[model samples]
Target: MEMLSTISGWIWNPLAYVALGIGVLFTLLTKGVQFRRFPDMIRHLRSGGATEGGLSSLQTLALSLSSRIGVGSIAGVATAVAAGGPGALVWMVITALLGSTCAYAESVLAQVYKRREHGEDRGGMPYYIKYGLKAPWLATIVAVATLIGYGFVFPGVQANNIASSAELAFGVDGQVVGVLIAVVLGVVVLGGTRRIVKVVEAIVPFLAVGYILSALVIIGMNITKVPDAVVLIVSSATGKDQVFGGIVGYAVAWGVRRAVFASATGLGEGTFVAAAATTTHPGKQGIIQAFSIYIDILLICTASGLLLVVTGAYNVKDPAGGFLVEHVPGAVAGPNFMQEAIDSSLPGWGAVFVAIAVAMFAFTSMVFFFYVAQTNLVFLLGERRSKVLEAVVKAGAPAIAFIGSSVTADAMWAAGDIGYGILGWLNMACVLLLTPVVRKVIRDYDRQRREGLDPHFDPGPLGIKGAEYWETQKEPVKEPDRV
Candidate 1:
C-alpha cells in the first residue's frame, strides 16, 4: 500500500505536471483548433447508429465520454481538494482549455492510422504508434501496458468507489454490489463493442445531462456564493489567497493531475473510440474529441468541485496527513464530499440519488476497460489470437472489480494513477513524434473545407501512406508532401 501511494504520488506530482506543458504547446501550435472548430464539432454530434461494422461517429463520442467521466470526475475531484485545496480547481480549468489541442491531435491521428479489424474499424494508441512512428516494439509496449493499467488497475478504482459509495449511501453490501456490477458488465461486454457502444450511446447522455442538471440546481440554490468560490479558486492558484497560501504548489500539481485523470486528454484511451468512428474526415472526430475535453473538465469536473466548495461541504488534508482545514466536519473526504454536498443541499434522498448516478457512470467506465483490454489482446495476438486469451481477460477484468470492493479507495486510486501516468506520458511522446503526420491531415482537411468541398480523408491524393484501412487501389496523386 505504501509503495503504491509513493509511486502514484511521484508520477502525478512532478512527471504529470511537466508533461502538461506538451498540451499547452499543442494548443498554441494548432492556433487553437479546438475553438476554431467548435461549431463544426457541435454539428458533427448528429452522427449515430452502426455502419460498416463500426460505431457511428456520435456513438463513438459517447463511448469516449463514458470511458472518461468516471470516479475521476466525482471522487477524484474530492481527492484533489482534500490534498491540494480549492486553488487546484483553477489549474483544472486551465488544463482543459489547453489539453483540448492534445486531444484533437491524437484523435485525428488514430483515425488516420486505423485498420479494419474483426469486421469493424478499430485502432488506438498502438495502431497510430506502430504505423505513424514505425516502432512496433514501442507500440507493443504501450498496448500491453494499457491492457494492464486501464484494463486491470483503473477499473478497480471505479469499482472500489462504487462499492464504497453504495455501502455508505444505502447500507447495501459492497460485496453484493461488486458481484452485480461484474455480472451486468460481463453481459454487456461479452456482447462485444457494438452492444457496448449502443448502451453507452444511451447511458452517457442520460447520466451526463442528469448530473449537469443536478449540479445546476445546486449551483442555482447557492448562486450568490458562486462568485466568491470562483474568486477563491483563482486567488489560491496564484498564491494570492492567504487562506490557502501554504499549499499553492500542491494545488497546482494536484489540480493539473486531477484534470488529466478526469478529462483523459493525454491518456491515449480516447483513440480506442476515435479509430472506430465512421466519420468522413479524421479531423471531424478529432474536433468532437476536443469538445469532450471541455465537457469533462469545464462541465463535469467543475460541477463536482463547485458543488463541494460552494456549500463548504469539503475538507483539505495537508501532506503531513493532518487536516489543513475542515469545512465539513467528519466527512472523511473522497466520494463522501460530493455525497455530503448533495445531502446537505437536499437532505435525505441526496446520497441515494448520487449513489445510483455513480453506479451507472462507473459501470460505463468498467465496460470500456474490457473493450480496451480485448482490443489490446487482439493486437498482441495478431491473426493467431484465440478465444482462450480473450476468455481469460474477460474473467480477470470482473474478478478485479469484485476484489476491488474489499480494497481501500485510496489504494485503488493510486494504482490507477500509476497506470494512467505511464500510459499518458508514453502516448504524449508518440503524438509529438507524429507531429508532421497530424499536421498533414489537418492541412488536407482544412483545404477541402476552404474549397467549399465536403472534406474526406484521401491519403493517396495527400501523399501519405501506412494508413492501411484508408488505402485505395486508385493511383496516388503526385503532390509535394509538405504540411
Candidate 2:
C-alpha cells in the first residue's frame, strides 16, 4: 500500500502541472472555444437526435457521463477534500473550466478520424493515433493500456467501493454483492454498445438528478456557511488559509488528481463516445462533450464537495501523524465521510441513502467501463472480428468484477490512478501534435455556420490526409466537359 502511494505520488507530482499546461495551451489555441461557444454546445445537444439506426449525441454524452459522473463525483470529491482540504474544490473548478477546451480538441479529433464498425461509427485515442499521427504501434500501445486500465483496474475500484459501502450501510456481505453485480454486468455488456447506451441514458439522469437535489437540500439548510466554505476553498487552494496554509502542495497535487479522476478530462475517455455519436460536424460533438465536463465537475462534483464542507462532515489527517480537522473521530476516510455529512442533517438514513446512490452511480460506471474495455478489446483484436476473443472478454469482465470485490480499496484506487494517469499523458501528447488539424476543422465549421449553412466536415480543403471516411464528404470531381 505504502509503495503504491509513493509510486502514484511520483506520477502525479508533475501530472498536475502538465494537465494545466495542456488545458491552457488548448484554451489559447482554440481561442477559448469552450467559453465563446458555450451556448452553441447547448444548441448542438438538442440538434443531434440520432435516427433509428444511429447513436444520438445525447446518448453518447450519457454514456460518457455514466462513468465520468460516477463514484468519483461523490467519493473522489470527498477524497480530494480530505487530502487537499476544502481548497481542492477550487482546482476542480479550474480543471473543468480549462479542461473543457482540452476535451474539445480530443473529441473533435475523434470525430474527424472515427472508424465505421459493424454499421456504427466508433473512434477514440487509438483511432486518432492511427489516423492523425499515422502511428499504428503507438495506437496499439494505448488500446492495450486502456483495456488494462479502464477495463480491469478501474472496475475493481468501483466494485470495492460498492461492496464496502453496502456492507457498512446494510450489513450485506461484500462477496455476495460482487457476484451479483458481476452477473448483471455480464448480461448488459454482451448486448453491445446500443444496449449500454440505452441503459445509461435512462439511468444517469435519474441518479445524477436525485444526488444533486439531495446535496442542494443540504446546502440550503446551511446557507449561512456557504460563504465560508467558498472562501476556504479559494484560500486553501492558493495556500492562504492559516489552517491549511502549510499543505498547499498537497492541496494542488491531490486536487488535480481527484479532478482528473472525477471528470476523466484529458484522459481521452470522452473522445471515444463523441466519435460514436452521429453528428453533421465534428465541432458539434466537440462542443457537446465540453458541456458534459461542466455537468461532471460543476453540477455533480460541486454538489458533493459542498455537502461535505458545509456540514463539516469530513476530517483531514496529515501523514506525519496528527489531526488537521478531525470532524469525525478516528475515521479513516472513504464513502463514510460523505454519508456522515448527509447523516448529520438527516440522521440514521444518510449512510444507507448514500450507499444506494453510490451503488447506482458506481454500478452504471462499471457497466460503461466494461463497454469501453470491450471497445478497446475489439481494437486490439483488429478488424478480423473474432467471436472467440469477444466471448473471452465478455466472460472475463464479470469474473474480474467479482475478484475486484475481494481486493482492498487502497490498492484498487492506486492501480486505477496509475492506469488513468499514464493514458492521460499519452493521449494529451497525441492531441497536442494534432492541434493544428483540430484548429482547421473548427475554423471550417465556424465559417460555414457564419454563412448560415448547416455544417458538414470536408477534410480535403484543409490538406489533412488519411481521413478516409470524412474525405468523402467533399463534392465529387467533375470530369472535364463532355464532348
Candidate 3:
C-alpha cells in the first residue's frame, strides 16, 4: 500500500499539469471546437442510427457514459471533498471544461482510424497509434498496458466501491455482494459486445436520470443552503476560505486527479467506444463525446459535491494526518458521506439510495471495462481471434472484480490510479503526435457543416493515410436518423 501510494503520487502529480496543458493546447488548435460546436454536439447526438456493424450515436454515448459515470462521481467526489475541501470540486469543473477538448481530439482520431473487425467496428488508442502514427511497436505496448489496466487493475476499484456501499447500506456482508456482482458481470460479459451494448443502453439512462433527480430534490429541500455552498466552493478553491486556506494546493491536486479519474478524458477509454458509433463524420462522434464530459463531470459529479457541502456530510483531512474539518465525526471518506448527506434530510433513506446508486454505477463500469479489455486483447491477437485467450478474459474479468471487492478501498484506488496514469501518458503522447491530422479532419468536418450539408468523411481527399475503412467506403454517406 505504501509503495503504491508513493508511485501514484509520483505519476499523478506531474500528470495533472500535463493533462491541463494538453487540453489547453487541443482547445487552441481546434479553435475551441468544444465551445464552437456545442449545438452540433446535441444535433449529432440525437441524429445517428445504428447500422448493422456499428452502434447509433446515442448508444455509443451510453456505452462511454457507463464507464464515465461510475463510482468516481459519487465516492470519488466525496473523497475529493474530504481530502481537498470544497475547493477540489471547483478544480474538477475546470478540468472537465478543458479536458473536453482532449476528449474531442482523441475521439476524432479514433473514428478516423477505426477498423472493421469480426463484422463490427473496432479500434481505439492502439489502432490510432499504429495506423495514424505508423508505430506498431508502441501500439503493441499500449495494447498490453490497456489489457492489464482494464482487465485486472481497474475492475477491482469498481467492485470494491459497490461492495463497500452495499455493506454500509444494507448490512450485507461485503463478500456476498462481491460474488453477486461477479456473477452478474460474468453473465453480461460472456454474452459479448452486442449484449453489453443493450444492457448498458437500458441501465445508463434510467440510473443517471434517477441519481441526478434525486440530488436535485435534496438540493431543493435545502434551498436556503445553496448560496452558502457555492460561496464555500469558490472561496476554498481560491484559498480565501479561512478554514481551508492552508490546503488549497491539495485542493488543486486532488481535484484534477479525481476529475481525470471520473471523466476518463485523456485515458483514451472513450476512444474505444467512440470508434464503434455509426456516423457520417468522425467529428460528429467527437462532438458528442465532448458533450459527455460535461454530463459526467459537470452535472453528476457536481451533484455529489453539492450534496456533501450543503448537508455538511463530509470531512477534510490534512496531509499531515490530522483533521482539517470533521462534520461527520469518525466517518471515513467514500459513499458514506453522500449517504449521510441524504439521510440528514430523510432519515434511513440515504444508505439505501446511495447503495443502489453505487451498485448500478459500479456494475455498468465493470461491463465497459470488460469490453475495453476484450477490444485490446483482440488487437493483440491480430486477425485470428484466440478462443482460449478470449475465454481467459471472459473468466478473469469477473474473478478480478470479486477479488477486488475483498481488497481495501485505498489499495484498489491506488492500483486503479497507476493503471490510469500509465494509460494517460501513452494516449496523450499518441494524440499529440497526430494533432495535425486531427486539425485537418476537424476543418473538413466544419466546412461541410457550414455549407448546410451533412458532413461525410473521405480520407483520400483530406490526405489522411491509413484510414482503410473510410478509403474503402465508396458509397454515399447515409443521413443520420432523427430522434
Candidate 4:
C-alpha cells in the first residue's frame, strides 16, 4: 500500500499541473479558436475536402477516438477512481473541456506545416516543434518522447487491458486473448493508416454508442439514486464529506490528472489525427479533433462515472469477488462500482459487458498507439531502419501484457499512474515552448479565413520550400544500404 501511494504520488504529482498550465496557456493564446470555429469544424468534417495526402475527416476522427476511448475510458478511469476516488471524475471533465482547446491549436499547427512522406501527409508534434518553431532538436526530443510514451509503453498497457478484459468477459485464457489482440493489431496496422482507419471507423462508433446506451439503461434503472450519487461525487470533490477531512486539494488534483490522462487532448495523439485529416483548413480539422475530448472525457468518462455513482457500486470493497458481493463495500481499487452496477441488473452479464467493452476499446487503442509509435520512429530514425525499431516496439506488447495479466490490480494502477506522470511532464514542457508557433499558425489561419480564401491555411505556402527553413538545422543523413 505504501509503495502504491508513493508511486501514485510520483505519477499524479503536482508537476502534472504543468501539462494543464501549458494547455490552458496555448488555448488562450489561440484566442479560443476551438470555441469560435466549433461549427465550421462540423461542416468541414461532413463536407469533406480535397487533399493529395492525409485521411478523410471520418478517418481522422476514427483514429483519434481509437486511442482516446481505449484504456483511458476503461482501465484509466477505474485506476483514477482507485487512486483518487469518484471525485476525480470532476477534474477529468474540467481538464477535457479546457485541454481540448489546446488540442485544437496544436493539431492545427501540425496540419498547416505537414509534409509529404511516401505519398501521404505525415505530421504531428514533431513536425510543428521542429519546423514551425525552427527548433529541430526540440522536435527530435519531443518526437522521441511521444514515440516511447504514446507508441511503445502505452500500447503494451492497452494490450494488457484487452487481454485481461477478454479473459474476464468470455472466460478466454489471458495468453490466448493477448495473441488474438496482437494478431488483429498486426493485420490492421501493418496495412498502414488506410486500413487502420477502416477498422477503427467500423468499430469505434458502434462500441462507443453501445457502451453509452448500456450505461444509460443501467442509470435509468437506478434513477431513484441519481441525486444521492451526484451529492457524493460533488461532496467528495468539495471536501464537504467528513471522511475526506481537509484533502480537497488531493481530490481536485486527482480529478484534473485523470481527466487529461483519459481524454489525451494535447498529449500528441490528437495532433497525429489532425495531421491525417484531408482538409482545406488545418483549423477545421483541429476543431473536429477538439470535440473529441468532449465526446471522450465529458460524454464517455462522465457517463461511466455517473453510472458508477448512480448504481452505488463505486463504494464496493472487493471488485474481484465478481458481481455477487460487488461494490457494496466500497473497494479501494478497480471497477467494483461499475461491476456492481452491472451485476445488479444483469446478474453475471455485467462483468461480461464490461469485459467485452474493455477488450474492444483497449485492443483498438493498442493498434492506434503502435501506429503513432511507428510514424514517430520513422521521423527519428529516418526511413532506413524504422522498420526494425517498429518491430521491436510491437514485440514488447505481449510480454508486458502477460506481466500485467498476472499482476495484482494495485500494481497495475500504480504503473499506469507513474507512466502518466512521467510522460505528462515531458510533453508539457515541449508544448509550452512551441506555443508561440501555434499562436502564429492560428492567427495566420484567421487572417486567411476572414479574407474569404476558403480557409486554406498552409504554413508552407510554397510547399517544400517552407520546410527548408527548419531543414538546415539537421545534419545530412547518409543513405542506408537497401536490399
Evaluated with lDDT, which candidate comes out highest? 3
What order do you get sorting by lDDT, best first?
3, 2, 1, 4
On residues 108-167, what C-alpha lDDT tens digit does candidate 3 reach at each position?
999999999988899899999999999999999999999988988799999998888888
Local accuracy of candidate 1 as per-residue lDDT tens digits, 254-372: 99898888878888889888888777778888898999888888999999998888988888886777687888887756778888888887997668877887888888998888888
Best by TM-score: 3
Off by over 4 Å in 2: 473-483
Query: Better model by TM-score, 1 or 4?
Result: 1
Residues 1-483, candidate 4: write the lDDT tens digits.
Answer: 668768768666676576567657766777776678777767666767434555777678878888888767766676565545567777787688678876787676677667767677788878777776678897788788777666545665666665556655577776677566666666666686667667888999999999899989988988999888787777767778664424556556767776776777656677776876666556677788888887898888988888876765654222233322234654433444456668887799777788778878887777777678767876786545655776776665544555555555556656666666665665566667656566665776688778876665434442333443224325322212211
Order of quality (TM-score): 3, 2, 1, 4
Predict model 1's lDDT versus the native: 0.83
- What local lDDT score does residue 57 receive in model 3, on the 0 to 100 scale? 91
Q: Which stretches of candidate 1 lie over 4 Å from their true place?
A: 47-49, 473-483
Estimate the TM-score for candidate 1: 0.95
By TM-score, the better pick of 1 and 3 is: 3
Global Cα lDDT for candidate 4: 0.68
lDDT of each: 0.83, 0.84, 0.92, 0.68
